[model samples]
Target: MAASVIELSDVSVVRDGNTILDSLSWQVADDQRWVILGPNGAGKTTLLQVASASIHPSHGSAEVLGSKLGAVDVFELRPRIGFASTAMARRIPRDETVLNSVMTAAYSVTGRWNEEYENLDVRRAQRVLAEWKLSALEDRKFGDLSDGEQKRVQIARAVMTDPELLLLDEPAASLDLGAREELLQLLSGYASAPSAPAIVMVTHHVEEIPAGFTHALLLADGAITAQGPVDEVITAENLGETFGLNLSVTRENGRFAARAA
Candidate 1:
């Protein structure tokens, strides 16, 4: 319901004298899809944790969907945001049916319980599975699917509730070239849809960024190196600064490619 889907002003996260995020200020409007790009230890995932309300910032303010992080009941706020990550994937039962893996999101629980689910929930899961091309795998155990298929299922499960904001952490990680392209195509199509939820995906590789993502935030050493429209923030100089290397970057047909120059 808020015009600003996510806003972080002077946000900092510290633990045991280590600062994971350093005085970060960022905002995401309702219409934007953002890619988080940074090298390892750049605090990309830390930033997502703050935005998704999994943790409060040590200082400054965070607001998502009109709810301020520290002031709101996170349990109530959690379901309004959809998050998918490797840590979350580990929580799902390996033998869980693909259909129930998604259907369980409606109740905010990890596994299907003895409580009866509504017919509409099942229908919604079916539709989401179809959207991710997981309809055929609905009867299969989650563990039986390949890495790429499991990632798609996770994305589908995250969107099952139609969250106002969707957060994906390395949705394309560890995939073969073909699988990576497949997931990227699906994400690009989802992002291009005007009706899709505002999205933020964290990835270590520039090539993993989907075509329709509109904005980017580049972080390095726990601070922002660049943040703006995708084309501007992804230039060679900016990327070089972000990654501590001399780099050459190119974009064509809404996709990006980069290498050390």
Candidate 2:
């Protein structure tokens, strides 16, 4: 069996006496692709943060790659876990070139510096950019790129370090139909790759799910409503409960779609 990459046992996140995540238990094994579906304020981003080691749960145990939270060096563990989010995107220097932005990820830094990177590091950055179809925009300023381009660049930057786990928070948010489709195709390719890392993506729209995702977790009110294999967990019954609405789900060519019943 594949090793577990992420594990949570009765994890809870409390803020000002309110629970953001309540006794959430989950496990993501190596090479598995997972989708986190939830409504606004459902703790999707919070779960991603815990997986990335950016946040510690207020209670319960959380582990990533055999390193338990609160008992390991997070700095050393961070590079092994890639994370991309809209909030982090806004923190990046817009004036920085896209290539430079990706290169800096190897060192977990943002913005330009006078330091020289090794040849291999530069090559890796370029390779990641090519993987994301952003090679043509390498010289463009990150701020000048279109939303879709920027999103791709950010993803390239996140994976430049060859992380064992990749967490994407709303990768398809704010994209137009064409751009979303393009991004979904790119994600599908990545997810299907034999060497792809374990992936967990948080998204509200079922249409944003890529073709190769294998499992799913549905959250509502800071708790898990359903979780299991994609076909079993991403049904109309589970989604309706998670989103508090009548939803009909359909699958085609390994991708998922949903509509009001």
Candidate 3:
């Protein structure tokens, strides 16, 4: 059996006297690619934080990469997990070059300082850039890139460390049709690779799900509506209930689309 990359048991998070997550339990295996669907404020980001070992659950136990959250030093555990999100992106210096932006991830820093890097690190960063199709833009400033290009850079940076678990928050949000499709294509190819790490991505739209994702988890009101194989969990009935509206869902060629019915 594949080992569990993430395990949450009756986990709940409360902030400022309000419940952000309520009794959520989930397990992700090392071989699975998962997509999390939810409306705004459904605690999707909070869930990812728990998985990334950035935040401990307010209640119950949480485990990531085989270490219990409260028992482990997150500073040490964090390097083993790759995380990309809008919040993380804002920390990068606008003047940082694309190659530096990715190489800095080796030290888990947002920007390059006086950190010493070896020849092997530069080669690894260059290889990752090529894999994400950003080799040509390696010398370009991160702030000068297009939205699609910036998004790819973020993912490339996340994987630069060769983490065991990867967490992405709304990676395809705000992209145009062409940009979204291009990003999805790259994500699909990465997720399909045999050596790829366990992945979990959060998105508001099912249409943004990539082709090779194997599992789905739908969230509403800080609770899980459904979860399992992608084919079974992303149905019209499940989506309708999750979004509080009648939705028509379709799946063809391993991609998903949803609309109001």
Best by TM-score: 3
- Compose the digit string of candidate 2's lDDT tens values, residues 1-261: 799999999999999999999999999999799999999999999999999999999999999999999999999999898898998899789999999999999778888687779999989999999999988988999999989888898899889988899999999899998989999999999999989999999999998989989999999999999998998999999999999899888988988889999
Runs in model 2 lying further than 4 Å from the true structure: none
Please report, in order, the local distance difference test score of every candidate based on alpha carbons.
0.93, 0.93, 0.95
Clash numbers, per candidate: 0, 0, 0
Clashing pairs in 1: none
The per-residue C-alpha lDDT of model 2 at residue 163 equals 89
Which residue pairs in candidate 2 collide? none
Task: For each candidate in turn, give its C-alpha RMSD to the true structure in angstroms.
Answer: 1.1, 0.8, 0.6
The sequence of per-residue lDDT tens digits that candidate 3 reaches over residues 1-261 is 799999999999999999999999999999999999999999999999999998899999999999999999999999999999988888989899999999999999999999999999999999999999999999999999998889999999999999999999999988899999999999999999999999999999999999999999999989999999999999999999989999899988988989999
Candidate 1: regions farther than 4 A off: none
lDDT of 1 at 161: 99
